[model samples]
Target: MSASPPSPGLAPRPAHDATWRRDAHTIGLVGLAHGTSHFFHLLLPPLFPWLIRDFGFSYAQLGLLVSVFFAVSGVGQALAGFVVDRIGARPVLFAALGCFALAALAGATAQGYGGLALASALAGLGNASFHPVDFTILNKRVSTPRLGHAFSVHGISGNLGWAAAPLFLTGLTHASGSWRIALAGAAAWAVLVIAVLTSQRAAIADRAPGEHGPAHHAAARGEHPLAFLKLPSVWLCFSFFFFSTCALAAIQSFAAPALHTLYALPLEVASLVVSGYMLTGAAGMVVGGFLVARVTRLERIISTALVASALVLLTVGQQWWPATAAGAGTAALVLTALAGLGTGLAGPSRDMLIKQAAPPGATGRVYGTVYSGLDLGFAVSAPLFGALLDHHQPAGVFGGAALALLLGVACAALVGVGVAARRRAA
Candidate 1:
C-alpha cells in the first residue's frame, strides 16, 4: 500500500541484523526440507514408465495420476497462504514435510494403482502446504533489502530439490530393485528435516510478526477469488509464466522417456538426463537471483530467455538423435542445459513481476493468485503435449512447445516494454 522509487543502479549490501539472518537461515533449512519433499514429489513424474511397468498402468491413467497431483497442489498453494497467515509458517511446513514423508512411504509400498493414487494425492497435499508457507516466511521474516537474493536462494534450493530428486531416487530404486527404497530414503530425509526445525524452534518464534499485516484480512475477504483475471499485467505475466512452466512441466514429466526413446539409453541412464534438466534449473535459479540485483529490465531478460529456450527446445525436438550408440546424449544434454538457464532467469523475475502488480502488504495473495497461472499452464499444456506425444511424432511435441514459448516471449516483451515506458513517463 506504499510506493518506493527505484534506485538507478544495483549494489551489494549486507543483510539486515542478526534476527533477519537467523530467519533466513531457518528458511534455508525449510528450503532443504522442501528439496527433500520435492525429491519424492517430483520423482513420480519421471517415474511414469517405471510405474507403468511395475503397476500396469495406461497412459491415460498415468496422466491422471500426475495431473491430479499438480491440479491439487496448485489450489493447495493458495490455501497454504491463508493457513500461513493464520497459524505461522513453522507448524504448517513441519506438518507438510512430515506428511509428505509418510505419503511417500505409503506410495512406495502401494501394491496397486488404487493405493498409489491415494499416496499421490497425499503427496500433493503435502506440496501444496509448503510453497505458500515458504514464500510467506521469506516475505515476512527476511528484511526488505535482502528479499530478492533470499528469494533467489530459496527458489534455487527448491529447484535443487527438483533437480536432485530423479538422480537420487532412481539410484535408490535401481540399487534395491524397488521404488519402496526410494520412498524410505525420502522418509528418512524428512525425519532429519523435522529434527533440524525442532532444534531451531525458539529462534524462529522471535522473528517479528507484522503488527498490522493485512494478509489475514485479505484472504478472509474471499470474494472475487478470480480478481486477478482483471489485470493486464497479471494476464501478461501469466502467459509468460504459463509458457515457461509448460516447458518445465514437459521436461520434468517427459524428458526421461524422450531421452530413452530417442537415444536408447537405459531407464536409469535416462533418469540422469532428467536430473540435468532439474539441476540446470537449480543453477538457473541461483543465476537469476544474482541477476535480479543487476538487471533492472527484467521483462527484457525474461523475454530473451524464453525465446532462447524456445529455440533450444526446437533443436532438441526436431532432431532424431540415436544417442545410445553415438554422441546424441551430448546434444540432448546441451539443449536441456540451455533450457535450464532460461528457467533460472525467468522463474524469479516472473514472481517478482507478479508481486509488483498487487498492492503492498498483499504479496501472499498476489503470489497465490499468480501461481494459479502456473497451474493452469501445466494443467493445460501437459495434456496437450502428452496427447501430442501420443498422436504425433516426437518432433511435433517439441515444435508445439516452441510455439508456446514463443507466445510467452511475446507476452513478456509486451509487458516489459509497457512497464518500462510507464516508469519513464512517471
Candidate 2:
C-alpha cells in the first residue's frame, strides 16, 4: 500500500525564511525544559551533606530519600508517555514544571525526613515527564536536516543542568546562610521558567504527527497500549540505555574515589579529574552534534564510540600504567576525559537510533519505556558498586563500569543490525 501524504499541520516549515529562528526557539525551549529536569535530578543530592547536618539523618536515610525519587521517577516515566500521547505533550510539559515548583517548595519548607521524601517523590514525578515531552516536541517541530543538532543541544543542556546544580545550590546557600533559601530560590526559578515557556507556548504546542485526524484516532482506538513491546528493536534500545547508564552511574558516583584510592592522589586533584571528565563530555557532545549532522551511519558511530569508551575505562580500571603520584593523576585525568568524550560522541547518534526504532505515532511511549532503563541502571549501580567500595576494591568499580560499557557496545551493535534488517525488509 502507498503511504499517506504528510499532514499539513505536521509538515516541516520552509527552509528559506525564519526557519533558523524557529528551530532556535524550539530547541531553546525544549532544551531549557530538559535542563531544568536534570538540574532537579541532582539538586537534592548535592544538598545531602547539609541535610545530614540539619536533620540529623544518617547516610542510609538520606540515600533512601534519593532512591525514593528515582523509584517514583522510573515508574512514572514509563506511564507518562501514555498520557503525553493521549492528551498531548504541552499540558504534560506544563504540569511537569508545576511538579518541580511544588517539589522545591516542599523541600524548602520541610523540617523532617518525611517531608523531604515527599518533596523528592514530587520532584521525581515531575522529572518523569520530561524525556517524552521534549523528544515528542523536537521530533515533530524541528526540521529534519537540523534534528541531529537539536538533539545535541538538548543533551548539552542537560549536562549544563547537572553541572549547574552544585554551583547554583552551593552558591545560593552561601549567599543566603540557609539551604532553605536556596531551595526557595530554585522553586522561584522553576516558576520563572514556566512563565517564559508559557509565553512561548505556541512554539511548543504538541504537533503530534496526526493530531485530531484519522491516523491519530486510529492509533488511539485500534492499537493496543502495550503494542510497542512487540518490536524487538524497542527491547534492544532499552538494553542500550540500561548498560550505558550503568557505566555512567559508576563514573558519576565513584570515579573520583577510585582515582584517589588507586594513585594516592590528593582529594583536590581527584575532584579535578572528575570535573574534567564532565567538562570534556560536554565538549564532546558539541562535537557529536556536528558529526550527527554529517554522518548517516549512526549505528557505526555509536558502536565505535562505545568501544573506544570501554577500552579507555578498562585501561584505567586495570591501572595498566604505573602509578607515580603526579603521573598517575595526569593519566587518570586524561583517560577519564577520553572515556567521557567517547560516550559523549555516541549520545546524539544513540538518540537518533531510538528515533528509528520507535513505532510510528508512538514516540512518547517508546522513549518513556526505553529511558526507564536509565533509572533502573542507576538504582542498581549504587548498591552493586557500593559493595565493591565496601569490600575495599575501588578498582573493581571501574572494572565493572568497563564491563558495562562493553556490554552496551554489544547492545548498540545488535540494535544497529536489527534496524538495518528492518529497513531492508521494508
Candidate 3:
C-alpha cells in the first residue's frame, strides 16, 4: 500500500462549514448509537443470576452464553468493516439496531438454554459493526480539530451505556418480578433509538459506496485490497485491544459474583460496583480527552493509566479491607471505583492511539480488524474468569484482571515504539 497521510485532494473545510453545531450534532448522534450498542453488551450478563436461578444453569454454562455472543461478533466485525466500506455505514447501522431489538425479544421469549443461545448469537451479530460504523462517520463528518473531543464523547457515551444497563435491567426486573419483562423493556429501548437515529440519518452516515476522496487513495494506487494487513502497527494495535479487553471481560462477567463471595456484600450492592466503575471511568475519559489534546505521546498515557488500574486491582485482590461490615463494604466499593477511574482515564488516549495506527482511506477496514480483537478478548476471557469463580477462586478474578492489564501495558509500550519507528522512517 502507499504511504498513509491525510488526503490533499480535498481542501480543508472552513470554520463556518465545519461549525461547532454541525460537529456536535454528528458526535451526539453517533454517541447515542454507540451507547445503545454498549447497553446491549450487558443485556444478558446483567441477568445472569436470574438465568441461573430460573434455569438451574451452572456459572460456566451461563458464562458460555456470553462467549457465544462475542465469539460470533469477533468473526463478524472484520466482515462488517468491509461491508461498511463498500455499501455505506448508515444502512448497516440500521440493520444492526434492528438485530438488537430482535435479540432482546428473543431473550424475552426464550424457554431454555437453546433459546438463550440464539438470543446471544443475534446480539453478537448486531454488536460487530459499531466501531467501524461510528469511526467512519466521525472521521468523515466531524471537523479535524474537534476529532479529539468526538472521540472523548464517544468513549464517555459507551461507558455511560455500560453504567446504565445493570440499572435498567435489574431495576425493571425487580419491579416486574420477571426477567422476561425487563428484556421486553430493553427491546422497546432499542426500537426507540433506531427511530431517533433514522430520523437524523444524514448526520451519521458514511460507509457508502465509492469516492471517499483522500481517504480512499489506497485503492487508486492499485495496491492489493488486503495490503493493510502488512502494517506492523495494525497488528500491534490489535494486540493492545485483545489484552485490554480481557481485563474488561473479567470485570463485566465475574466481578459481581466474585465480590459477593469475597466480601459478603449483597448481590445487589455488588452489582453496583460495575456501575460505579463505569461512571468513574467515564469521568476519567473526560480528563483523558483533554490529555490527548495537549500531549502527543498517547501510548505513555495509556501505559501509565493501565498500571495505576492494575495496582488497585492487586490491592483489591489482597483483601486489605477492614473486617467490619461498613468498613469492608466501603473499602471494596471505593477500591473498585478507583480501579475503574484509572481504566477510564485511558479510554480516549486508547482510541487516539488506534486512530493514529489506522491506514489512510482504510479506516473502516483497519478499525474493523483491530476492534475485532475486543470481541476475541471478551469471548476468551469470560469463560476463563467464570471458571475461576466456579472453582471458588474469587480473588483470582481481581488478580487475573490485574494481570491482563499488565500484559496490555507491555503491548502498548511496543506499539509506541513501533509507531515512533514508522514516523522516523517516513
What's the residue-level lDDT of 87 in candidate 3?
A: 74
Off by over 4 Å in 2: 1-15, 52-63, 174-177, 208-215, 264-269, 272-275, 322-324
Separate clash counts for every candidate: 2, 0, 4
Candidate 3: where is the Cα deviation over 4 Å? 1-18, 207-217, 322-326
Q: Order of all candidates by TM-score, from best down to worst?
A: 3, 2, 1
TM-score of 2: 0.88
User: How do the predictions measure up, each by TM-score?
Assistant: 0.85, 0.88, 0.94
RMSD of each: 6.3, 6.1, 6.5
Error of 2 at 281 (Å): 2.1
The C-alpha lDDT values of all candidates are: 0.69, 0.81, 0.88
RMSD of candidate 1 to true structure, Å: 6.3
Q: Which pairs of residues clash in candidate 2, taking residues 3 or more apart in a chain or in different chains?
A: none
lDDT of 3 by residue, 1-426 (tens): 987776665545465565888999999999999999999999999999999999999888988998999998999998888888777788889999999999999999999999999999999999999999999899989888889889999999999999999999999999999999999999999999999998998788663445463335555787666888998888888888999899898888788888888888889888998888889999998998899899878889999999999999888877876545576866886788678888888888888888888777788889899999999999998988989988999999899999999998888888788777778899
Cα lDDT tens digits, model 2, 195-218, are: 999999999986544556223664
Number of the predicted model whose TM-score against the real structure is largest = 3
**Which candidate has the top score in lDDT?**
3
Question: How far off is residue 103 in model 1, in Å?
Answer: 1.9
